[model samples]
Target: MTLFRAFFTLSRAAQRQLAFGAILACLAALANFGLLFLSGWLLAGAACAGLAGLAAQQAFNMVLPATGVRFFAMMRILARYGERLVTHDGALRIIGQLRVACYGRIAPQAPAILHAQRGGDLLARFVTDTDTAGQYYTDVLIPFIRACVCGIFFIAITAIFSFHCAITLAVALLLCIVIAGAIKARCATLSDRLSATQSRIQSELADTITAIGESLSLGASFHQQSVIMQCQAELSATKRHLAALENGASSLIAFCATLTALCILFFAVKDFQAHLLTLPEVPMLVLGGLAAFDVMSPLPTAQKTLAQVHRAFDRLEDACFSNTTAKSTSNDKAFSDYSSLQFENICFRYSGQEQDIFHHATLCVKQGERVAITGPSGCGKSSLISMLFGFYPLQSGRILLGGSDVHTRTPEDLAQVISVAGQDFHLFNGTVRDNLLFANPASTEEDMVAALHTVQLTDFLATAPNGLDSFVGDEGLQLSGGQAKRLSIAQALLRKTPWIILDEPTEGLDATTEQHLLEQLIAARPDATLLCMTHRAAVLPFMTRVLRIQDDAFCPSEEKKP
Candidate 1:
């Protein structure tokens, strides 16, 4: 089966729940039909009996019809209530399946794809798209199926009273269904076109919001605001168009339904006048005929929802299976400890860039060496770190860590040995211990505390009432910049990898603290190979070597005496 088709059968639990809910819906609908038809029959029979005579009224038995009406009324209410609960729960289960499936499909492609799109765009696929697909089961798929089953049963029940009447109802139902199907096809086409624009608008808005600080700082906030307003206007205009189309479709269906009911009533009344239909049975047939048409009431909404579901599915497919992600190279070889890391004849550039960032570049750090990489802004300091971790595919040459080529290594294997603390270190809205635990989940409290001490955060931990349990707030904003940086370092320390790459490690600290933090990092892993990408020339004394970013070549720096 194709990937999308496989999604339907991925979770048996959801399927079973959906089936159970559908059964309840069918029962509820049938019960409603029974209530309306029987109530009409009872009322008509009593009126006729009373007009006949006192003796005829006494002979009429109202007990069975009255009890049946009450039974069906109660059953209808209870069954409908249960059906809603079951269907929604089942829809939630389907959402769970989509969440997991999408995660699995997008994970491997994240690094490459994430850089190309805004976070909000991806969030829509993961959050909003799943919601739409789940509604497919509850609002569209389930209702459409229920309508079919009820329609068939309704016609069969009517056939018992009169074959000609049943056929008339069947023809009306079939015609209405064809109309619904046509609306659905058109809706799906429109939705597909709209979904792409919606995703783009969502991405643009998210990107703008995320970069609001930068935009304000650069004095470009007005431009960004104007762009956002434009997008919103376009979206609103598109929505109005969709509403107009839906309104037109609804009116057409309503017209068809009213015409069908009147025609059926006319035929029934004529048959009754001819004595072919009994007086008491005539009301039941008319009511049943109307109830049978109720089966088509959900058709318009079902068609529209199905169109929405298809739109969501298409967007999710684009997000997960997009061609933007570069092909990955996988290796199963175990990473062995090495005294040095080698970047040999490396040539690299960002995707779609004409110029190479690193052309025949080479770098080597000996075992247990402390090397500080100093470069001008936008000199690819962080890019080097990202490439080392296999976040970006190698354009040419190879990086050898512990004698094994990194390009040939699986990301899992690479991760086991190389640990990095990036410039924009993410602290993942969590507690002090929780963030640390992310680095080495198997580590105990003792290991965690020791790692924290290695980064010189022990005193801060002792001062807090929560200590290791201290809440860091969102993005560790509760802590000072230096403290957050130290916490990230501590998390990396918890990993205990031989190679530790720190991108701007001592950023956001005073002169004295910067030196102190550098000392602590050097002391934290005395035997581990440490590489620092920073602009702090004052911290060079602490490093075995300093390399400066230059115009022509990346060569050894003239260490400035602090």
Candidate 2:
């Protein structure tokens, strides 16, 4: 019943569509039962009539019974085909809605979610989770309902021949249903384990491929290959366990079905001898009992699917119903006018670590200042910048941008005041023009060309094929290191916000290129506040003021003025 709740979360239209598919499925099951019973009834009746005499066969009038046989057969075929068509369409629709819902839920949690999971794992959730969540309703729920409908109808029709015989068939069918339910519950854990393991293996394989170029460059290719192989072996072991359980349950269902059919046949023979049922109808009861059991075949598989559906819903619910769904009540006030950037009594640390990366830190960068922050590696310089931009919750203090509390302003509002070009900004698999357009979709070609010129890439673009329309491959793999870093700078400059935060933006560039680009950024955006975090000191002479991070606080640089 908990799994069934996942269905109602869809829109009413989708629920109705799925219900229609189930109705068609039930009709198809009944048709199958009707076709089997009528065929046995017709053939046995014909053989008995012919044995008696050719004239008796002529009197029986075979046309009506033969027509009944054909009717049920055609109905079964049509209904089954319609069921498949409608159910698949409904399933596809549900998958699309779920994809939208999942993305909507996870967007707020962003890099926070990525911090808890590998990017490949999130990618797998986007793709695989949506596909499996619908299977619980279509393959399992619909089929189970169809079997119940067919079971009841078969028993009711059998009662017309003899009340006592119907009671016997009903008991046998209920027993099989109970046993299958037990098997399904027993194997449920195995199904859940298999689903989880399968997803991990898929994510691991994807991560392996994405990082292959890096691993080979680091001369750690064999280490990466070993990790992938271990994951594959564990996945294989889980699959084998699942396959064995399913096979065993299927075998149990077959045994119970055979035993039930034999019991029904025995009762039918006894009824015939007692003169309570006709001799011609005996084969109909025997074959009809076997046909009744056919409807129960999906029961075992349905139980296995129930387990898998539970796992998928758990993952989806974790993503969609996460705590991040809480809406921010912060004001949407933008900081257009600037006086200074200030951090007062700032304290910060990662979520599960005790030591604060920065405790009681304070600094001020006056408006329209070009400041560079330099520090040793892993000294929380980037983390401090992240807090300044409102990327995460502050530990115990406030960050004021243009005198507004960073926590009190929304991210969209902050975007108007600040733009960041990080060391690891992504370039999607798209055209150079498309990537640039992401910063501002309404930007004209003239604005784009000007941004490229500021970053000193205009000459390179003039000689390149496809120019702005050239594909960047995945993560801009086709570009050289310097080209990728310069493109990122070009994107940040296009924002033209009141504040620009550059984290190691010129790392891959030569000294002349770095100095030229930094000088251009300062000249063009003389009114904008620039905060650059860099390891290299080549671009420092162009900065208006330089600060060095030491002992958990920002202060004037110890080095000589550039």
Candidate 3:
């Protein structure tokens, strides 16, 4: 979708709040102009009256106009505060909604679509870039709206004193706007480049931090530091260039506003000489012109901000919605309770690869059956699991679950029916309960304990200071490899799905521990279908049927249990 359309859709939720905020901003601008104009007019009149002696001083009433000055001053302050509060709140609300929507879009296109992207780059785009996009509403859009509305109002007020002055002010404001637009156009390419550089810097920093230990061991920490410093220097140089352009724009805009005020003063003096304008009206008109420029002063900054916002939206759009293979499937479709899985005539290959991982591969697993799939390293075992989860699109194949196409099921539906515990599983840096609840939010303490017991983590849970609430350090770094893997298994088991897929489930465990885990894992999910991909023979006897990949297709293995 176009950026405009995307922005519109994402901002619809906060439109009411933003619209109200815009109105308040306009009010604030008008009040500020009123304060300046009334103060100038009132002070000029008072000075003139005092110079004209007692009679004129008596004729000039300062009480009402002074009161008007105080009123406008107060109004300006309150309105400005209200405007900021409402607009920022609305902007924050829109940003929060956008983040959620962005995550929802990107979540489905896992390893395949996101493999090339660095974690930090993706994070910067999702969080930082998306937040920058929100500034378009508050910084660019609102300011532009206030400038236009208040600009017209100021010009109308000026026309009451001198038509020439009003026309001059209008032309100057229009010129400033035109110049700001030019700046925006010029900054577009620069902003895009800056955004890319920033993302790269984040990626580099993240990689360095994540591998700090390895870098230190290899005596390469200084190299990574140098690289980061180089990126930082490039970023600083780009920002400096952008700032120069912004500062130049602001200087030119201020010059135009000052020149416009002088021209208005010249017109006002001529009208005063012609008796068309009074002395008090001269200062009022000149100061009013300056106040009007205040409304437009933010235009240059807004225009410059627009360039960055555009880049942010473009990055968010690409990261969130691009290259997704999700299909429009009916969520209402009924999924059978005792469904069989069928992979028929499957053909698959990764992008930029010469060989097919699977070619005309067919496999069938009946309900409640234990199926084992074995293949050499670098074969398609893990890829097959990814396919089952719709993480990658098949070149030519259909995976059926319960007589329905696997592709036809929603992500939520698929998650409800199948759970996979793979090697190299990630555990979030949160409490153990938090991780388990993430898999199944409805799971209770009893359910979690049972799953933990099945994975042979009962002893650790008992010894953990906070039991289920015990924190798992980053990626479960606090736990041993076996404990981490078992915890992940417990998390998967908490899903209580009809089918569970295990990929090298016991790869790092000893034979005795692996055997015990396999036994308990099967016993815990007695009626659930099990699909395991393994190189180890210890798990083979538990499988009702065994299949091996030969020439890119599954064949009945000779080791299958009779």
Candidate 4:
């Protein structure tokens, strides 16, 4: 989506809050301009009475007495305060919703889609861009609405008094709006470039932070620091240049407005001197014309704010909605009685590669079968599993679960019947219980302990300060690689799904730990179908069948029988 359309969509979602803010801003603007008109009238009346020596009688004849003026001033104060409060609160609320929406859109995307994106860039979008988008409501929408309302009202009132002043104010206001639009149009390309660079710098910083330890170990800290400094300098320069451009545009508009107001004052004074306009109308005309300019002084700043919000919208749109190429099917198919998963004549390859990773690879595992798939590195074993789990699309084949095509089933349906634990397991910063029971919120303490016990993690839990409630730190840094793998296994076992896929589950574990894990898997659910990919021959005895990838094809090895 274009940046403008994305911003409009985000604003449209908060239309009710925006409308309320707009109404309050309009009321505030009216009160503000009304005070100017009333003050001018009071001054004019006092001058006429002072010249005639009837000040008290003229004050009583005035539409707004001293008390009424005080009350109007207080009303204007309250309206301005309310407008600020409402606009800020509304902007915050919309930004909060947009963050959630952006996360929700990305949650279901395939691993390939996520792997292609930089983690740092995603973080930037969530933090800076979302915050910037909120300016649309607070800075641009409310102020622009108030200015337009006040300008139109002031023009109408002036026209009732003199068409010449009204015409001048109208033309000036139109010119101000047109000039603001031109400034925005010119800055659009620059704004987009700034946003992209911002995202890139943020992403790079995140990566640098994440790998700081490695960088220090490799003596690359100076290199990383130099890169960060360069990025910061570039960011500062771009911001300063943009600010200067916007300031220049605003100054030009303000100058034009000042000149126009002065011209109107000159005309009003000439007419009054010739007796064509009454004495009481002189101050009213000047102040009314000045009020029109006051209402429009901030229009250029509002336009600049809109440009920032538009850039933010562009970043958010690219992150959230632009990568739909990996969207899976949305059909609902029952997985309750899944007896087997079958890969029928499956042929697949990575994008831009000529050789097929899996050519007409056929495989099937019936209910309760413990199947082991072993092969050398780069034999498409992991790719085969990815295709089975609906992470990769088959080039020319069908994957069936319970006699139905996997692609025809919704992701939720497929997940219900299958569970996988790959080599790269992720653990969030939370209690150990949180990581173990992530898939099952309703799991009781007893269930958590049982899963841990089944995975041979009972002893490790006994030595911990808080047992299962111990904090694992970020990405389970508190645990060793083997401990993390065992935790992942416990999590998968907690689901107790019919089909379990474990890819290199014991890669980082000691021999004893690996052997213990294999024993536990055999004892936990012998009836559940198991598909494990590993190069360790120690796990072979537990498998009921062996499938090997040979010459880019999956075939039964003669070492095992079906």
Query: Which candidate leads in lDDT?
Result: 3
Query: Model 1: per-residue lDDT, tens digit, 1-562?
Result: 2435846776466777778899999999899899888988999999999999999999999999999999999999999999999999888877888889888778767576667777887998899998888797778877788888999998899888777778888888888788778777677776776676777778877888778789999999899878778877777877676676767766776777677667767777787888777788777877877777666777777888788887788878877787453455676556655767999878878888888888888888888888888888888888887777667766787888867777666566777887888887889887888999999999999998888777678888999879989989888879998899988988888898888888887788788777667777777678888888988777778878789866524788876733
Q: Could you tell me the lDDT of residue 356 within candidate 2?
A: 81
Q: Residue 500 of model 2: what lDDT?
A: 88
lDDT of each: 0.80, 0.78, 0.87, 0.79
Tens digits of lDDT, candidate 4, 1-562: 5545645676676678778878888877777676777788778877777778665555546654555667668888898788788788878887887777778776656564677889998788888888888787778877678777878898898888777778888898888888778788757766776787787788888888899899999999999888878888888887877788788878878887788878778877777777777777877777777777766777778887787787788778777775634346666546665888888998888766899988887888898888888889988878865676566667898888888887776567777888888777799999999987796787899989988887778899999999988999999999988788888888888888888888887887778877888887778788778888888777777789888888777777655433
The residue pairs that clash in candidate 2, if any, are none
Winner by TM-score: 3
lDDT of 2 by residue, 1-562 (tens): 4324645677456777788888888888888888888888888898999898988878987899789889989999999999999898998888787788778767656554447776666776777877878786787788689788888998999998867668877987787677667766656677666666767777777777877788789988888778778877887887777777777767876787687677777778888899988877888887787788778877877877777777787877766565531244456455665677788988877667898878888988887888888899988878865676555566777877768676666666777777888877899899889999998888889988999898888877897789999888788888888888888888888888878888887888887888888878777778888888887878677677888887877878965546
Ranking by lDDT: 3, 1, 4, 2
Candidate 3 lDDT over residue span 356-450, tens digit each? 99998899999889999998988888888888877788889899887788887766778778888887589999999999998899999999999
Q: What is the TM-score (0 to 1) of candidate 1?
A: 0.89
Please identify which of the two predictions, 2 or 3, would achieve the higher lDDT against the true structure: 3
TM-score per prediction, in order, is 0.89, 0.90, 0.96, 0.93
Better of 1 and 3 by TM-score: 3
Where does candidate 3 have its weakest 10-residue lDDT segment? Answer: 325-334
Candidate 4 runs further than 4 Å off = 1-14, 54-63, 324-327, 558-562
Give the CA lDDT, 0 to 100, for residue 39 in model 4: 80
